[model samples]
Target: MRTKFFIFIFTGIIFAGGLLLCSNIKTKEIQFEPRQEFSNEIKISKTFKVKPGYKLIVESDIADVSILSHQNDEVDVNFYASGSSKYLKDLKVDFEEGEGTLTIKVKRKREFKFFNFLSEWGIEKAELKILTPQNINAEVKTAGGDAHCEGLKGEISISCAGGDIKLKNHTGSARLSSAGGDIIANDINGELEAKSAGGDIIVRKLSGSIVAKSSGGDVKVELINAMGESEISTAGGDVIISAPSNLNAYVDLNATGGDIEIDFPLKLEKKNHDKLKGWIGDVKTGTKIKASSSGGDIEFRIRKGEI
Candidate 1:
């Protein structure tokens, strides 16, 4: 028994010493095949016949989206893509059609291969264009691209995850949002809501009410004939608002780290370097105009040659 016990202890010590020595041994570094990229071009086209109350919903993984309207009561869609899928297969689309509703959803299933030398990795850029019936409600979104919509009537919402959003000749209730880019609207009416995460919000020739906010960029709004109780705020950029000379608005402006300036006649209630509350034309029957900035100036101006 003593002899057997001695042998077992000796074997255990030898095995531990071998493991300790093996821990210090040099090993080859892992190498991946020099960042190879694979890309493809894809084109998709679809058309749908619609009724009186139709709705269009489109979603893209990474694409530039554009929407336009036509006279006929049909919705046409076209998508063109030419780029890599960034280390995976191309995006898969699911189309769903229901009673007065059409949906196009794009999705990508991620896959990771360990010890893969031929993995594909690159950006995927795409363009989506849609021609729709007039006065159709629509909801459009992109994961990482720009968006442009023109002449779309009815309630509409457009968004981009990492690019700019532009609206031209849009009417009715509209909402625009961007995660990391600007929001620009021109020749719009009705109601609008614009938001940005890291870029400016610029609206021109707007004949409606607006609610705009930005996290890290400027806010500029130019109004036309009439406006609703509008509110514009920013976290770290300037705010510039312009309206017609005879417009009636109850103005309330504030800036935490900058100045406030208004180039209009007013029954000034309160005035300071960073705060102002007054009325532009009629105090009793005016829309509320509120703007605030935390780190930049706030300026209000009358329309050119109208004051």
Candidate 2:
């Protein structure tokens, strides 16, 4: 029994010494030739003579993209990736061209950390920049960056997981959705739809129909003309509407727990608890309007001569 015990202890010590020696051995550095970091700028300029009724789709993570209109008939694209050389080089961005569909995407890699202590040190990745053409239908999706587009005449759709969205001077139908940031749109001439989970929404110069819903912020809309209908709803902030003098549309305001105020061309009579039923002027047959909130105030202003 003593001999067996001695052997077991000796084996354990030998194994531990081997492990210690192996741990102390230096690991080969993953050498990157040139060692220089990658550029933060990615610029792309391309022109496409595409016919009408086409679509462009862009998908990215950690990038900000913008699209604008131009007088030329050709399409243009520009992009810049902001990251380390290894990270950027590892990304594979490719595009597919179709008769009416253009798809752009980035390939991502898996990164692993071996030590828990190293994992505790926060590391922030950089984003990219993308600029696309104008006058074309577009759909953009980003995971962790902001997106802005302006002066587009075709239909537009944008989805951001955790960044702000800004749109201006859009003449066609548009849909904007964000999961973690604010949404702002201005000078929109066509239909508009927007939703946010944790930020405010501001819209101005709306000409057609609009629908905005938020769960955690305010909603403000300034309407220049209402060709069809409009609706705005929120769960945690106020709702404000500013309509033009020529606005001749139906207005519906509802707030479950906030005050309802309406300023119209004609006088309004208090109908019920936090509710009012009145029209400033003759509304069109297809006009539909609604402003609702669950925990904030509601205000509607109708400019003079809006009848």
Candidate 3:
């Protein structure tokens, strides 16, 4: 009988220990729940009417801005605000329309609260999307997010302090600058000026003059047609150029601490391991293509079928 009693006591102790372990696990799970959850989000949108040939300006401090061209004559603007309840309430969007210009600005009201240190209050996010006619001039500025544009026939200018800038199928002149991100352009048909202080630059299918410079990243350009002067430089990365074999251009390549590679045939006016000055075809009719790198290699090559 005593042995049976001890056995029952042992079983009871085991069951109680298991239950206590499960209770502690549940408490830990509850403690971790707050850290895993993000604050609630709210979305807002607005549209504005804009005519062709009108100037469109977008200014935002922390949103990714995207501008796309359409055949429609009116412009549509969409804004998305995502954050805590207080953050959503503090967000504001303003629009102004003039005779020949439309402006959209995103602003956030300042607030000070002691409970803001709580982890439940997440970081805010703002996003803007603009659709305009195919012929409108655009100027977009963002302080902390990416900017993307496509299919516009007018001049497009973008400035970003902390995100990338991408331009595609732009037929008119374009000027872009990014202080903290990359710049990419494709299928551009006009004068191009692109600069980045902290990222790479990539250009493809360019048909006109291009001036691209990167203070801290690489540059890669593929010329579809050598129509005008091209200048590409990088302070801390490589420079690569691909052009047609029959391209008539005066080429100058310089690599300070790296190699210069030329895979195409050129009438060498001057040649060295780190620099080359030459012409691809007729010297007088040829355009000028200059590429320089301070800390990386420079390469010039002819496309496969072009040779």
Whole-model Cα lDDT per candidate? 0.84, 0.76, 0.85
Which tens-of-lDDT digit does each residue in 1-307 have in candidate 3?
9999999999999999999999998887653344543466656666667666899989986679999987778887888767666556665788998999999887656543565434124546668988888998989998768999999989889999999999999999999999999999999999999999999999988889899999999999888887778899999999989888888999889999999988878888898889999988786677999999999999888865321
Tell me each candidate's TM-score.
Answer: 0.81, 0.76, 0.83
What is the Cα-based lDDT of residue 237 in candidate 3?
98
- Assess the local accuracy of residue 150 in candidate 2 as a C-alpha lDDT between 0 and 100: 83
Instruction: Give the winner by lDDT: 1 or 3.
Output: 3
Pick the winner on TM-score between candidates 1 and 3.
3
User: Which rank order by lDDT, best down to worst?
Assistant: 3, 1, 2
lDDT of 2 by residue, 1-307 (tens): 9999999999999999998877766554455578465444344555566666578788975566766666666566666555455455555566788878878775454453444223212223434333445657888998767888887788899999999999998888999999999999999999999999999999987888899999999998888877776778999999988887655666667888989877666434446667765566774443668889998999887644221
Off by over 4 Å in 2: 1-47, 111-133, 265-270, 283-286, 303-307
Query: Which stretches of candidate 3 lie above 4 Å from their native place?
Result: 1-38, 111-121, 305-307
| CA RMSD, predictions in order | 6.9, 7.8, 7.9
Q: Deviation in angstroms for 70 in model 2? A: 2.2
Per-residue accuracy of model 1 over 189-258 as CA lDDT, tens digit each:
8999999999999999989899999999999999896666889999999999888888898889999999
174, model 2: CA deviation in Å? 0.9
Clashes of 1: 0
Prediction 1 TM-score vs. true = 0.81
